[model samples]
Target: MVSIKKGSLYIVATPIGHLQDLSPRAQSILREVDFIAAEDTRHSRHLLNHFGITTPLQSLHEHNERFKSPVLLQRLHDGESMALISDAGTPLISDPGGFLIQAAHAMQLNIIAIPGPSALISALSVAGFSADRFVFEGFLPAKSGARQQRLKKLLEESRTLVFYEAPHRIFDCLNDLVQIFGEKREAVLVKELTKVFETVYRDTLSGLFDWLNARAERQKGEFVIVVQGAQFDNKAIDPKTERIFWLLRQELSLKKAAKLASEITGVSKNTLYQFALDSKNV
Candidate 1:
């Protein structure tokens, strides 16, 4: 009795934690789809079973996405409705299924988006950071050096920064953040969002490190780290200096931008650096 359109591929968003977060529409489409393509058949099986959905499941993870797309597309061409679901959260946001979606477009097939829960958006909603303009740099590198190098690029980012970190490397990642972003940088760590042990811990980078180190239990869940962006002030300053500094910042890091702007404008380096941390830069 489900009204799912034949031959449409539904990019369904599953619940990140609480099972009830799944939309009624998502459940209906999933229940009636010809077959569901899932990131993990085993994990998606539990969710489907809970809702009493007996739809068949096919595995479509990062490893076999390329090879699997053609087969899935053929099913679509045969007028079969297909629903794609991840183990959790929306499919293709730091998860797989992007390739299949892309291939569907190339075939001129109807692709539907079924909105649902997302850990990234959920974390941002409660993190108390400015969400107007922020970046979602999914997960940092597992290795310390590569991760630190990656963090270095965002040192001057004026917009709020968000990242996902595994519990195993959370400590090392926080240590690198303290080392590069400075111990005093303001940040929030959200763990086990929307679940039983959901906790939101906001503190200076150094404080977070100590708190996590203090208790082994603190570092036991999935995490979303939201760091306050570079601060800026809305004070009157030389227009020429602002122009130069703003232009330089577009091409370089905060340190290099302030340094070069100071040189060009004959303004003190410290003064320009101060500009880098106010309402304007933020």
Candidate 2:
């Protein structure tokens, strides 16, 4: 029982990479709508030109969404049906459209979704990770310290974790993942999905880091990182003891690794540092 009305707000998902992925319903809605509020007018124009859709487009991106959304909402109030589209993929998904959608919802405007392609979903579909329960972390913080803090918290996450990273930062992001999730953590890096030269590389965090490092120039385009959930090691490797063991194993003679691991795992660096000393002596 779908009731689509005039003067509505249609949240349409555009193709993430390939234009053919745009659904027929999405195309119809975009063509039939009075105007389209797009994250990028120029990019939307390309899609519109491809489909021969000449609907008017207005910019409603991060730079001006708060100011522009009210105007779009007013147009909706004035009996103009508007469709919201991102540069690619779903709107309000790590994109600028949440505020506009919120205002529309608050005003009780008729809103409909013309679903199509989502980079996150597409990546997850091919990630070979648990899709049953996962969290879309959008994009990681650009700052290393903040990113590491967040990753530290997520290290204990029981559900699959998904994150988007840019080309230039993908390698650093993978390196940070190795540091926080440990070298042996399994992960999938999906790049250029649905486009020419699409790649899905899966391996341990350390191996992935090494692979990416070897091909530093190949780290380009949007990246989706799918990390497997934490597993319960029932072998009685308590968090504290595990931290000590990993530190002792990796550091060998260097006391810094043990001290850092203890600080990160909150297992008392002094104690672990002492253990490192004892193990070295043995």
Candidate 3:
């Protein structure tokens, strides 16, 4: 029999898509806990029914987490063990239930994590990119302007970048990526992961955009996009050239400034353009 410690909060990771991905230990903990705190009780009920786990569930989503956390903490203080689960994957990874966990820590309550599948990790595993160093940007801003602005900041990041994107915005996201990061930047798009129609496409940003546009059916699932990081140049920008560019930028349009600076400093136009982009981000 699985042991449940009194007054403990178990942070369990559920499967993202494939039901079989749920670990045996996670199943044991879920069945043994007094009650489960789920992001959506109705959605979670299906998962529970599959495993014949009848543990009671309480909703603890973003809207009501603040109000619900106190009550949950009191129950834990009174020695009721609970498990926190999201609709999919791990709780609090671009999901809700963070407040309850934070409250548990502040009170010095017993807390444990039951590791399992994560879409981020799964996508990275098959992304065919350098995973030695990477950044998990849970999701990008919904609006184009804000999303592009955020992408601009990440343009110079040397580490691989991972992001979760919705089906509807996948096309738009790719378009922006091609425009900002350039058409030839290597990237991978994994959709409907671990599902019957799972698809993985590895191509340049522009090529992926064109491929997705070929079939409407391809746009219909949760997407994990892995993008290769910018290749950093070994040669540093000359101090005088950068100073001249900034001084010109103050008085002229960025394009005009970069153009004139390139000519005056005998620097490549592409290098000066990139320098201007980095400066604006700063």
TM-score to native of every candidate shown: 0.87, 0.82, 0.84
lDDT of all the models against the reference?
0.89, 0.83, 0.89
Q: Which regions of candidate 2 are displaced past 4 Å?
A: 1-4, 234-282
Q: What overall lDDT, based on C-alpha atoms, would model 3 receive against the true structure? A: 0.89
User: Which of the two candidates, 2 or 3, achieves a greater TM-score against the reference?
Assistant: 3
In the range 182-260, model 1's lDDT, one tens digit per residue, is 9999999999988999999999989999999999999999899999986645353588788888888888988898788
Q: Give the winner by TM-score.
A: 1
Please report how far candidate 3 places residue 85 from its true position, in Å: 0.4
Residue 23, candidate 3: Cα error in Å is 1.1
Backbone clashes in model 2, listed as residue pairs: none
lDDT of model 1 at position 11: 93
Model 3 C-alpha lDDT per residue in residues 1-74, reported as the tens digit of each score: 57899999999999888999988899999999999999999999999999999999999999999999999999
Poorest 10 consecutive residues by lDDT, candidate 3: 273-282
